[model samples]
Every structure is written in structure tokens, then in C-alpha cells.
Target: MRIIAHRGASHAEPENTAAAFDAALVEGADGIELDLQLSRDGEVVVFHDATLARLGLRRARIRDHDWSDLAGLDVGRWFAGQATPHRMLRLTDVLAGWGGRTHLYLEIKHAEGRRGRDRHRELAERTAEAVRAAGLIDQVSILSFHEAALEAVHALVPTLALVRNVQRVGLLTRAAQQRAGLSALCVAVDRFGAAQRARLAALERPVYVYTCDTPAQFRRACDLDATAVISNGPAAARRWFAGQTSA
Candidate 1:
């Protein structure tokens, strides 16, 4: 199974920061997973939450401000470390810097309760441009829980690999796979059962699990033949997987 760093070794560094991603690479993670949101000026920035309040800064919406404004905020204080202050990262920076070295899983955050046809399209256009500019269009796979957002991304870059991220396993997932032309399934490892694993296996596509920080969860992912295991601690997962492979 592949070990993907969730938010770039978040257990060690602030989530979604360049330093965190660099640490993940230094620790030899197989993949790096991150979330994307569009700024006011249509820049695709890598960040998890919509607000900056959790980072001990003002409660400002990332989408409401441009990248220049958001970049000035300290995004690292939310983590346990006292010395680290995270700078907002651009999606283009990650692709150009780390695309060839590690697998990139881009999760597009949906603008919930907001209605506009072009909003998703704008995000998709910026994401596509960045991926293409960095020559990572083939290497990176874009994913989203919202089907509409995924559709917008697919329209922008049809050849880009897409994954359907869902909470539960059911017809919705199956339908998403069919409708989105998704190449992989990313699910919560605990929600996957024998039947679901078998079903996904039969489809001949990869199945990935998210936020697997424990050894037992890693074992379950291995047993289920998961293609990728996303976790906050990539080093721990790497050691466990290496041991499994050697055993």
C-alpha cells in the first residue's frame, strides 16, 4: 500500500505548509495529500480550513481575500509547535517544487451554501493552469466530495486523474465513479468492509483511505489492498509498511 502524508506530516509540522511538505519529503513519504481553495483573485492556494481563526489569527475567510493578504497570516500556530509560523502556500509552488518526487493528491474544497455557476469553474481553471504550468497534470489526481466541483475540474482537464472521496460506501460512490470518470476511490478506512473492498478490487482501480494514524488502521489498509494510506504521521506509516513488506 502507498503511504500518503495527510497535510504533509501534520503530526510533526503545521498542516498544509511548505515546511510540513518538505518534512514529509525528507522522511520519504510516497505521496502528499492537500486541500485547495481559491482566493479572491482566483489564485489556487493550499489550505484545509475556510477560516484563519484556528491558526490564532483573525477569523477571515480565505476566499474573501487575495493570496497576498492571506499569505501574511500565520497559519502554523494551530499545531503544537511553538516556534513554527506557517505561510500560506500556493498550489503552483507545491507542483513545481515537489510534483516529480512524490505523488500529489489535490482535494478541492467546495463552497458550501454559495450559489454561482462560475465559482467552481474559476477554481478549476486556476488549478488546471497551475498543474499544467508545473508539468504535473499527469502526475496529480484531483479529488472532491462534491460532485459538481469534481465535474468542473474534469471539464477543465479531462485527462487529469480524478478520485471520488466519500464518507460511506454505497450506490452514491458507484455512481460517482461512473459519472465523474474517476480513476480511484478514497474512503475512510473504517467504513470499508469486505464487500466494498471486493467490489473496488473487481473494478481494477485504486482504493485509498484517509487519516490513518494508527498501526491497526495501517494493518486494515494493507489487508484491504488499499492503494494509498493517508496519515498525519508518514514516518510511522512508512516504518510499519516497510516492516510489513519485509515480513
Candidate 2:
């Protein structure tokens, strides 16, 4: 099974920062997962939330700021023990830097309503364009909770592969998966079990579980025969897996 770093070893480093990705590699992760959002000026940036409130900037949203404005912000200051501040990265930059080092899973943040759909399409297009430009068509997978975004990506980059992050297992119908051309399905670690695993397996695609930060979650993922399990601390997960194997 592949051990992918959730937000790139995010437990020790600020999520989505280059440092976090570096840490993930050092921790022996097989792949790295990151989030993508559009900047006000039309740049595809690597960020998770719609707002900067987590960074202590209230009422400040990611889409409200231009890339130039967002690039200067110290995104790492909010994380404990992050001695150095990190800046937000653009998809162009991330692709250029980490394209072939390891597999990547790029998630488009969830959004709702008609306006959100428009934004999703734009993000999907831009993200797919960037990945194509970087020559990572075989190494990266575009993911989104919104099937529309996945559909947009499928239309733009038919061979790039797509992943759908489903909230409720039943919400992911065979037709929806077929429509998105999903290469895989991802679920929150807590939501997957033997029954759910069998149900997802019927699609005949790999199953990925996310935010597997704890040993139990990681173990459960393995038990469910996950193709890959995402976690915030790759090193710890490795140790846990090693212990299980040696026992």
C-alpha cells in the first residue's frame, strides 16, 4: 500500500507549504497530497481554506487577494514550532519544483452553489493546465469533493486521472464515478469499514482514505485493503506499520 502524506507531513510543518512537502519526503512517504485554490488574479495557488482566519486574518479570503498580495503573507507563523514563516505557493511553482519527485494528489477545496461551480471549473482548468505544462500527466491526480470540478478536469485533461472525495459513501453512485472518470475514491478514515470497503470495491477502482493521523486509522485503512492511505505524520505511520509487520 502507498503511504501518502496528507498536506505533506502537515503534523510537524504548516500544511501545504514547501517545507511540509520536504518533510514528507524525509519521512519516507510514497506520495504527497496538497490543496489548490485560485487567487484573485487568476493564479492557481496551493492553499486549503477559503479564508485566512486560520492564519489569524479574520474576514480575509483567499480569492479576495491577488497572487502578488497573497504571496507575501507569512502562512507558517500560525503553526506551533514553525520557526520560519512560509509563503503560499502557486501551482505553477509547485509543479515545476516537485513534479516527478513523487506522486501527487491535488484537491480542489469544496464549494457550493452556482458561483462556486464556475469557480470550480476555472480551478479545474487551471490546475489541469499547469499539470500538463509540467509534464506530470501520469504522476498527478486531480481531486475534489464536488463532482463538477472533477468533471471539468476530466474534460480538460482526459488522461491525467481524477479522484473524487466523497463525504457520504452512498453519495458516490456508479454513474457519478463513471461521469467523473474517477481513477480512485477517497473517504474520511472514520467513514470506511469492511462493508463500505466492499461497496467501494465494486467500482473496481482503488480506494484511498484521508487524514489517517492515528495508528488505528492507518491500520484500518490497511485492513480495508486501501491502495493508499493519507496521513499527516508519515514517519509515525511508518513506525506503526513496521511494528505491525514485525509482530
| Highest-scoring model, TM-score | 2
Displacement of residue 54 (Cα, Å) in model 2 is 1.5
**Clashing residue pairs for model 2:** none
List, residue by residue over 1-247, the lDDT tens digit for candidate 1. Answer: 7788999988888889888899899878888999998888888899988777796656677778888898887788777745856788899888878899888989888753374347666776678768877878778988877677677777877888888787877644454555656888787878875656677677777888887988888877876688888999998988888898899
Give the runs in model 1 whose Cα sits over 4 Å from its true position: none
Shift of residue 211 alpha carbon in model 2, Å? 1.2
Model 2: CA > 4 A from native = 111-114, 174-176
lDDT for each candidate structure: 0.80, 0.84
| Residue 235, candidate 2: alpha-carbon lDDT | 90
Clashes of each: 0, 0
Alpha-carbon RMSD to native, per candidate: 2.0, 1.7
